[model samples]
Target: MKIKVIKRRGFEEPFSIEKLEKSITNALKCAGIGLEEAPKVISKVLEILESRMVKEEVHASEISDTIELVFIQKAIRNPLWLNAAKCYVLYRIYSDAGKVPAKFSKTDLSLSFNALKVLESRYLLRDPKTGRFTETPDDMFKRVAYAIAEAEKRYGASESKVREYARKFYEIMSELKFIPNSPTLMNAGTPLGQLSACFVVPVADDLNGIFEALKITALIQKTGGGVGADFSELRPKGDVIETTGGVSSGPVSFMKIFDMATEVIKEGGKRRGANMGIMHIWHPDIEEFIMSKCGPEEVLKNFNISVAAYDSFMEAVIKDKKWPLVNPRKCPEIKNALGKEVLDIAIKCSEKGVEVKWVNAKHLFDKIVMCAWKTGDPGLVFIDEINRHNPTPKLGKIRSTNPCVTGDTRILTANGWVPIAKLFEEAKRRGVIAGIVEKEREISKLGEEKGYETEILVPYGEKLIPTKAVVWKIGLKNVCRVIFKEGFELKATPEHRVKLKQGPWVKVSELKEGDKVETYGLWIKEATVERVERLGEHMVYDLSVPGYGCYISEGILSHNCGEVPALSWESCNLG
Candidate 1:
């Protein structure tokens, strides 16, 4: 039963039955065929190959021909076995071209396994009829690059120039010098040409205008574009609808419709639909708008909610003044046709209800802050700040921010620390952290053993740059919020350490009340530790700071010495 098979390269090698069976199995799997008869089919193929191998050495093609001949004969016996054999036949072609490699070798274009999974699931071009992927990742990049470069040819480039630009574009992509948005990568060179990732749809007051915006929003979301809309123009709840002779459902009710519509539409059959809803702070239903995302369950989870806030509202909040919330329909000037067009006003069907609510601006601002703390929604958009540099004010005010916010490079901001790679870049500019980073340019690949993990550097107090300190600190760290079960709490980090007029600066973990030796202020008030109790994980001590504020673990208490009386803060934060 000893045999040697000849390869296409004219080389002789020992025949492996395992190899043949695995290849056939893969083919069957690719064709979505069952493996019930696979063992029998592989056995039969083996028998045929052995019978045909009369000589000590047999050609590989002969083995293939005998297997295929058996397939033709099996077709006469039963169509089931023949289908499996035919799958094997097609698998041969697929393996030679479309098969993903068992392993990715080290190369510039090589992708990670998960990256390949994502691309294979969606981005790779497939035959619509067969539902089989017809192109590889390299093919996708080339398709996207060439399709975009073709735009140059539309303006007046020759065929040669177009090809040259295509080559340059291909090089740019292959070298990882540039990458376009996901929609472009997916739809380029395909029938669907929509490539943008975000759209700002304007919602108008009337039913016609409102539905029109909803239609356009649906169209954009269907094509993988996220949409943002300003709902401030719509009248508040209980406002009259002149056309229908009924009360309006209001902007929030319409927002629910938009949310439901987005839920129904799956963007590009791959990405989920996304939306952003913005309402002005002066809207009469501002309180209702602020509390929209609160209290347990949610219907508009797909949306990123935001409030359009101006400097005047913030000023009112600061001065603790009663702010006027006005209905656009109430004023005669606002209701006039010319005023309506410029200011976006609509007539209320009746005037029986109160058109304005004068609320304490501080209370409204506190509510917004509290809701935002609960769920990371209702991000504030500073209206005055945005328009301070508006390029075209003549066109009208910019009401809604785009669905996606694009920024230049990676920069340090109030949001934690920058990326590790960004930190390394800054360190290089300052001539630091090279020894810490060594040669690993990619920060993600670094680990805890390498003196780093996933962490960002932020500022604490003074000019001190601190970190979650996992990686070489990016910047100073700041203590933002102290979460308490019902009161104040602090972690046992070195940052929570406070100084005493004795020994060295000790951690809040070590000291308790009645153990203090030094006077805090300009003179001693002759006070001993009043009380100590454990609230959850925090060991809090009563080192009363005149303001009824107690110290925890003797934790950093000086910084929070705001004489503004003890307040029940779910998240103790200072601006």
Candidate 2:
């Protein structure tokens, strides 16, 4: 056959049809395509090439694309033409792209052919009844594996290396087939791009602020963010209304809007939104707030409700004192009350049990603990603690923590508290200090008082004193000094002046006849000495040292020798 090669300035030289045919034959031979099929595939490609608008400078990429399209549409379905056509097209493209030629010299193509056969077996589908054809989902993976195996076999790649490549190809296929988490699988490659577990919104005092927050919350929830809000800032029920000249519904009434919002939002069009609603203890409608969580006419079952308690209220409970229930609107005075006034009201309430739904502080604490133990709901957060530790303490007091209290930044600016006390409690139980400042303070106090700094180690028991004297003598300096430093003025007791005139010590042998001694702030007559011996580092003197003494041991008297008398320590002066 005659051959013509074309060349143009600034372009790679192109070969004639005869030369292209020989090149295809060589590539097919290298890829192990049978000589019988190679010529037929090359002849068909030559026929298609004759119709192309021959350019002065021919780009191999353009030719490859055209050839691939032709093969896909015509030759791909025929098993006999498939491998040869693939080899010819791949060779032309690789030659143009400067990639390794798709040809084998000495290596056998059996492994590559077998790999392709496995792919075809798994991924080529035929209608069971009609015998029509279809490609299975695994077809793409199988094709990739077949291509890799063919390349490795032709290149004399190591068996281990070829197996490694095969394993990686399988892994890619497996991952493509596996299911992922909802957000990751849905939004990972999508445009909207919101992937989070929860969000918290703040309900402000004004209508614009409230509704705006609600709208944002709805938008977030619509995209699958669980939301919580603090409704405590809303004015109480029946409080003065400037806009409508009528009584305004309290936080509980407004909470219905949130509940309704949750119903409408629909998380990713799948589930209802979850929320937490909280109110402070000083709220005018706090009674309503507590009841809103329970009772037949409850408003928000979707929301977890909590009461924000301050430090003073918690302390009053610890002291078994009364606590006042002050309305934020009507009795705003009690909102920031402290010291004796708050304590007095609390105590009065405790006495009467009717001032404002009086319940024992411990009882309320137990209710909160028990409820959490049962349903894992109604979490508590120390509101004062939250505020004290808030980073932006200057902005405003934190009214509530978020639903989970995973953090506190939201609380400072959000004007709401959702009690995450259970979460905090859980963190504490795990020994993780969620509140760094609080934990530091506790550790500091413990560190300061760790050693021998005034500890009461003696167990409770009867004590005795000996040798009565006039007032103004017994060592009261240390006790008085401690009291004075503690900001307390000590009153003089009748026995404060009693003096230890002489010999507050007694020997084991010298203790005998009509002895009296003082031990543990009490005076007692001493009986006869029973026995004496050495115990470890100290001498054990068994003297009758103290009130109602009967066969007293030396160890007891010797260990307490600071208050023991001389010879008189042994005698029984029981009268």
Candidate 3:
């Protein structure tokens, strides 16, 4: 017998268990309920309701009430689940009453109205039954503070000491002194406590490696995280594939696979995830990679393309000399070539002859600048400068940075990584720097074949083995954008207003890369053009400032820069 549900209107519709499952799943995300377990919550609620009501027709309100009852009961025993239940109920009430709840527990913090809404939507415990906020801003602060502070307990801190740290954390937050990243704030103290905001997954050159990275990318985005990848390792277009005896499609073509996947996964229909696509300056397909995002419609919107330049490349540009572009497969570091060392490698391929092409350094640089002038993309990352500050030389070189966070975290390594936090606490008690080596030694003893990937702990007690192909694992803080704003479009071009101190002020339509510009955000700041792109009628420019990167379209340039005067900056993060 179909369970017919009466809607707020007079119409009747069949009840959908899938619909109920989705509701429960969304509510559980508020508390870190896994896919495997969240369905059980829905089954429990449905079971309870069916036992009480056997009628052929039931009001939607009655169904809503039964789910609420189940939520209330479960939440009481597992207090963390209360947050999920709260959101469910609140959303249900709003549905039935057609009004958002006005009464909320008051907190001492002085917050903007918009800020309060953000806290409610993203941070506060919600009525899981209704998908609404039930906890206040104060409640969120306490939860996050206590959760992060608990990490100190791993340091052998006494109970009193840990509690004091938690108190201090709460004080800082309540005073509006410090705030964690979105992941920390949203998942903290919850069962799904993934603290990192971004993941840099490696896309190995081979078929399985590429798909494996794609799989990891999907998993990360599903949890509302971003990813960064360097595709310089993949062979260029028209390269030979020995295994299939076919020509290779190259990195730019393969990127579409990741791009299409992103279009579908799209962070569970909430927000499409973002990616950083980087290509080395000397890669055989550097030109193709740079031009990949160039069409009128633009390809790969989910990605931020950048050229990974080394100091030597810039030196070649200054000297106006021919730079050698090497085939990625020919690097001397590649010891094993899947099978018997292929004789026709990049060094001296009998079929293709020498795999090196020399192009005017300045000419290549100009191409990057010109493309960037049209599209605010293919920015440059000075790899030499990045590796200079790396603390872990033993791990390997840093190739790219995550688009979701700022600065180089220097956690780059080959062949995946042992979960830091999962093994970190136990490792730290043993020692500090030496303990990491000790853990590596310990893991190594398990045999490379058998212990290649170890199941590691994640927030919310989820066990996962990190991807082996990844070369970088960035340390992340909550992005201010996700914390305060909701539903970010994937790589939407931003409109920027330009005010030049004493030059011709024009809209983005006329803006070009390498233009000196004045920027205003936190006070005022000086900025220079890294790249620019024309998306239809509007021109977008990527700005490089002191510490970070920012992009905007000339459409936002309300004031003419021809009349403004130059001055010092208060603060800025555009890169």
Candidate 4:
């Protein structure tokens, strides 16, 4: 005869030996006891349950009592069983107590004690007169559900349909299957009604623009939103302010002002204010930005800073090349020398207007890695990689991310790209392939061609090697127009590696007017640079090939991402 176990609430269910075994095994594990003897101990406990089989239903407490009695008997042979018995009893007590809050003990929601405490303090509506919690956990879920579902009325939903949807929403929330963002949980139904968790504010390079962004940031944080801004537009430190007749203090100094404001304003007066500060790699004061929060003292405590590393900078780091830090104000004017056969942009910049500083890429990258290890302030944001997945190409470049990095852009996939604005949309989209991303988590493969099916020509030292496209990507990269004296032109990122006549890889930015680079058509041939100039921004695409880590782009040899060597090596002393 099958026996049923009667719960404390008077609900009866068939006794599950599997559940009993799992519970006893958990108790044993918690007490640091071996599980090898668990099955034997469980069998002894089951011997007692055999007597209760004559009854149609057995009280749940009786099963617990029998388990405790068996554990006590086992304690005579092994003292560790006593600890296991105590753990088993304590588990029962807490599990019972955790079912619901004291006032709503009969409610079906199974919330832990800590969860209830959090709800009472931050979520549960309180009585204005008494300042005591006026709503139970279930009531709190219901209030949020009803308020959100009521919006369906505006969308032509029927009253009965609205209630039904609200019931479903409440079911998901109360069961802990799904929880909305914090702002939605906190102020969705409240008067504040601000449901956004973060906002991106623009900061132009002027007095009015700076203060305007600051004011907007403060107001957003007041209503429970964090703020993020790219400070790359702001001129470098000591740049002349044409109107004020005083030199600008730079982006880092302005970041301090914003950080101070964030320190004073609590988000929604309930959460701490947060901000993300980003500066481009080409920004003249990038080193200063990287070291802003490097010390033991708390500096820019409210802000998280990141260097908007362009693909060129990363490529420079991997190839042990010099990375140029340029003034954004000078970029447009420098492009004016479009047809000039310039020796170097920095040398050309001096003739045009301002001088650019070139730092050893590996050394600078080491400083970034060290600073992140030291204070965890400065992190790298791959600007080129980010712009590649831009869905709205016509709407201009995406400058800043939200404080916690939420955006509805897109990702690279085979055949093209797909907008990642909605999860369901991405799922239904064709040409999306699976690949391993950071931390071994699988995501849509970033590609421009069918990875396994497509092959490309990769330059591998005096030979054009056929390589399969493992992955490919499409994005906006700062393209350098290199006109060869051999009557051909190639465009790619400044740091893109091309083969030199001496059989070494050299960056496009470092290639001089007379530098001879290798080219491929029927065979590898030498092409001397006639003119090297900045071609402004453009839609650029590249493929990731095996072995050589390079591909044939516009007849010139080009390297793929710089991640391979940078991630594998520990030494930064490579010349």
Candidate 5:
């Protein structure tokens, strides 16, 4: 059967059922739809168009819409057919507006196909990995483009100008891609609205407060945010319970609840929630807090531990003395206070040996350095440093930093690095015994002034800087520990190498390129030495330690080198 209609432009167009069927079949075949399904859809569409009893003014849009209705009713899911339906609908609309040519020429088909492919590829079925996609509804594309084009045409703009604007608009839209954070991506712009990276809640000494903190922490974890708590405010261990007259279990016991909470409250059902458990040095159960993260199997696998070192404790360590390990509840004055006076008490406690084991400051410092050297964690946050640099110091002393020891700007302005030594010195200058500087001086002298001989091996492109304080063993397999002015120490192993000035000198093994090394024992790690230079008789190894400071190490010659026992060479014969 054939149906012919003269277009309004006087061009006669003939439509054959067989031809329509063939076109539909080809489109469906290209779309990967089965012929059996495609024929039924095509037949329904052809029947509607053939039965058109309307005037010649009937638009192609109407015809395309009818076909689309049939396909939709048949539940057609073919991407190609869906795109073709949209393109047909758009063409019909354009034809009704007299914008399309009367005769459906090869040029028209080619233009429509190209336009449809671009639209579909840009909007439909986005690639999951690359996030790019194919065409969307042709009507929608035309609608948006037509609005812009019409505006430009109204302004008397040339077609080229309108097209250039359209291209620019599309380019902008293409780049406006957003990847939300874990929580926001999972929930936000969705039904569940919880979105946060970290949450901090108070845990009072009461049952309600304790459970409340745990519940909130659990909820935050459910939405995929880690939690940290300052357990210092909790009552001390062995404190008389007013409610039950029994001894309080203290912060350590309460921490177990949080530990259990972390164990059960999985983050979005994927992994256990991470937590940060902090206790002040003065807490009665401070020992448990410090040792919590130690041992073969840490009790809380998801928790990072930190001991909030107060001013006095640091002072005592500087003075090579003992520190007081008073419970926060007993020493309420130390709660949110920052200054040298508060530090004096900690120093006095250290002298009395009442605090957590008063060993050499060097020992504790060594342990921390070693752990950081190994695991890159167990971060130290000098409480005094945090409080001093805190912009809101007037509000209250910053009791805790973030889990990573990177201070939160909301509480402390200098969130990245806090100058503890400067603050301590300032406190002393004000006639406050904030720190035992004299004691720190003695310890520094004892460590840095000692005749420590270390032989270092340098690989290719490596050099050694000699320090007046350090005695270098210019030979192979030599090892020595570097004691800094502040009681910080590091061990360097040097390799034997021949140099111009010295007959044979041991070059400390320069860390491989890209390896992180630290200097001045200042808690900074991962600094790389950029270049090495010589200063007169001593070699200056120019080094850069990330986030802390840069320094140079120098070698010292032994006075007894000339009188050293001579090695007698003995010839051995192979028998």
Candidate 6:
């Protein structure tokens, strides 16, 4: 009878001595043993295997165990053999660990075992008394579909239309063609219908504004949303607080408070709380912000930091000129603050009245590059470029993007908060809102108010603009988290641009701490940076507003609906 080996999954295959020899040879190489000794090692292992071959078949583990035993005996003569034994054992463990479980079969929908595990742990609804899963993956999909379809009723959709759309929704979801943000996945069909994933809260220069933003951040995070904000407006460290006759601790100090708050809420929130911090390059605390993540102590792990750079700043760096760091508190009062050239580009890029500090542009740029290279932090966002392409410039310049920079956010449509992705689907499929036909009147009403034809309108400020188009794509890319001093956070692709304090655009990957990005409210404001973190690669989405070139996500003014080229997907994570 042919010698056979029983695999871990209870399957038998013909035992191949050649394959075993190769595995042992690789292990010996890793132990720094010469290849010439591989044959000698193989012979010794074969002797043991032959002794154990009493039956026609044997477990795979038996062969591996015998090899390990032989290597252990050799270790007494040479310690390097011990490494070979460890290597072989680790290889076996890795092979077993990587084995995929059988396909999930509980539901009609096809899903991997890993996917099923995720659903069971986080997505599926649970029984109140027993805390066991109350529904299957199919049931969860149906629940979400039915609940979302029910919303059509509020918008004048008939019973038949609602059911029809629900069926359609179910088909796409069940087939794995379309999936909504995490909040929609977890909270939809449940009482916790707060489904927005990214928000931008304003962090003004005062104590009240900072704390208020923190409060809003906590609330949104509790509902599984991430926040982004610009901290550039806050006075730098040691700035006199005229009201209390005390020195300000600056944005970096306040960022710690936000970080602590996020850490606390992440423990209890429906999902982990995340933040984006944007500080302007001109801020006096720019150095501190850039190095925020580089501290010896692990601080601001919950936040991301970016430096808001400008065209002039980059130009100055290239020209080896001095760049002026202006005081936000005094910039507005300075004559011609937004002029083409400051006092003199060569000497100082500042007006006569504003308080400014000069730094070598190349030096600053080098610091940003070095820090990012070392710690993968303080990404850059070009404020001017983002505004130049702002789809909804009327909405105020986009200061910060959503957590994912993907347009998985809800656009404040005339009808209400509609998923931007859904609108994109409508645009892609039919170029109109025929599926959600009820929104036509609301869009028309909004257009009438804005003095434009209402095809589909997204709010800008007091006005609304017709949505020109919604675009989407598929690819793996780096998504970064940027945290502001007052606890605002946004996640976007590395190259996504955000507004700087002085109204310039810079990339998220190039942002350093103390850079101020735009934040939305009655008007646009700057939030200073706390830190920046690379959250790794993910499949992202984008939404564009075309002429408007921007949209308000949660409360932040985001470029072109999301970060760059449109939207980013920010979903709720279960663990």
Q: For residue 183, give model 3's deviation from the true position in Å.
A: 1.1
lDDT of 3: 0.53
RMSD of each: 25.9, 29.2, 23.4, 23.1, 23.7, 20.1
lDDT of 2 by residue, 464-532 (tens): 212101000111111110021112121221111111112344433344333333222113323233332
TM-score against truth, every candidate: 0.49, 0.34, 0.51, 0.49, 0.37, 0.51
lDDT, candidate 3, 183-247, per-residue tens: 67777887877776666665666787689779888887876677777776687788889898998
lDDT of each residue in 1-575, candidate 6, tens digit only: 37888876677899897888887987787678888988887888777777778887888878877887888888999988877776664344333334222222233325543465456445666655544455656667788888899988866889999999989998898888998777777778887786677666656577866886687778778877887766776788998898989999999899999999998885123456888888777778888898889768788889877887777888888999887776656552211122233334313424345467888989999989988998878888776565566676543333222223544545556566555456555555642211111111222111111111112354444555444334443235568877878765766777666666555567778888887776654234667778989887655544544334566543455656334332111111122
Candidate 6 residues lying further than 4 Å off, grouped into runs, are 1-109, 333-352, 393-575
What is the alpha-carbon lDDT of model 1 when measured against the actual structure?
Answer: 0.53
- lDDT tens digits, residues 1-575, model 5? 54564443455576545645654555455445677876677678767766774543334334545666775554465445664554454444343334444333332243344444443333223334433322233223333443445457655788888877766644333333322244533343333455566655545556765786687678778877777776776877777777788988888778887888788878755457887766665565655556555546557666775666656666667777654455444444344344554555555545655443334544455555566565544556576665456554332223211000001101101122222222222323443111111222222111211112111211111332221111211211224333333333233333211121212332424323332333321344223333322211211111111111112232222111111111000000000
Candidate 4: tens digits of C-alpha lDDT, residues 275-324: 88877666689888888899666789998878766566677789898866
Candidate 1 per-residue lDDT, tens place, 129-194, comes to 555567666667788877887777646888788888888887777666787777788888887888
Give the better candidate number (3 or 6) by lDDT.
6
Error of 1 at 342 (Å): 14
Stretches of candidate 4 off by over 4 Å are 1-109, 126-131, 332-351, 391-575
Pairs of residues clashing in candidate 4: 388-475
| Whole-model alpha-carbon lDDT for candidate 4 | 0.62
User: What is the lDDT for 414 in model 3?
Assistant: 30
C-alpha positional error of residue 518 in candidate 1 after TM-score superposition, expressed in Å: 83
Model 5: weakest 10-residue lDDT segment is 566-575
RMSD of 6: 20.1
